[model samples]
Target: MPAILLLIVSGFYVGNTVLAEYVEKEAVKVPLEAYLKGHETGKPEYMQKAFHTDGKLMFIRDGNYTTIEFKDYIGRMNGQPAKDEANRKRYIESVDISGNAAVGKIVLDYPNARFVDYMSLLKIDGEWKIVNKTFNVEPKNSSD
Candidate 1:
């Protein structure tokens, strides 16, 4: 009887742990989905919802390392979809979470180039917000 009770308790603990992790993962996806919505709609409001007020994006441009404030980056969006929006594809590739910190991978496949973004996120005041982003772009040839 004691062994059966122990087994039941262990099962309960394992179930709770798995449920907690699933809940956390879903919570983390909230901000990531917002980020994707921003790209889909070309709206800064969505981006603002996804990132912290002081977030920034880092990448290499013209052979020089460059960083842009999230606000500035969103400001460049004209609230209009790209001309080739129909041909552009974007998605969250993966997300890994540990306590209050998490990281996400995103892919932006454009007609001319493919971009892979790594975003660092944190849970602040019970909300997950992207704190930083770094990405690399690969150009594609028309023939390929």
Candidate 2:
């Protein structure tokens, strides 16, 4: 029984190494770039990975800074309904790319929520990950 267990463990290790080596390069970056680009073009599906599964969002308003889970951010965004094509026009005005790191300035222009968002991103072990985010809605009398 011990021998059988040892063999199984060794086999699993070998298989894992082979699979890791066989994967193509730029494979992961494609999905990440696509997701960021989607925000520029307003593809909801692409917005999915912009946050980690257990990601958090931090922002400030009215002299207060608050942090919330990714799901809450998604829920708030989704809760507000918009007309056709309105959803896709939100653009990332600029994406500052530095090797594997990037920062995107996202401008969301909804009827009730017109804000400029800054996303601080990192290449966590080759995966594009959002580390910190800060944004504020354009207030009345403020130039967009």
Q: Count of backbone clashes for each model? A: 0, 0
Q: Each model's C-alpha lDDT?
A: 0.95, 0.62
**CA deviation > 4 Å runs, candidate 1:** none
Give the per-residue lDDT of model 1 (tens digit) for 33-131: 999989988999999999999999999999999999998998998887888999999998999999999999999999999999999999999999999
TM-score of each: 0.96, 0.55
Give Cα distance to truth, residue 34, candidate 2, Å: 6.3
* Model 1 RMSD in angstroms: 1.0
Model 1, CA-based lDDT:
0.95
Per-residue lDDT for 81 in model 1?
Answer: 82
Pairs that clash in candidate 1: none
Candidate 2: misplaced stretches above 4 Å?
Answer: 1-45, 76-88, 141-144
Candidate 2 residue-wise lDDT, 22-75, digit = tens:
442233344446545654544455556666656677778677988988666556
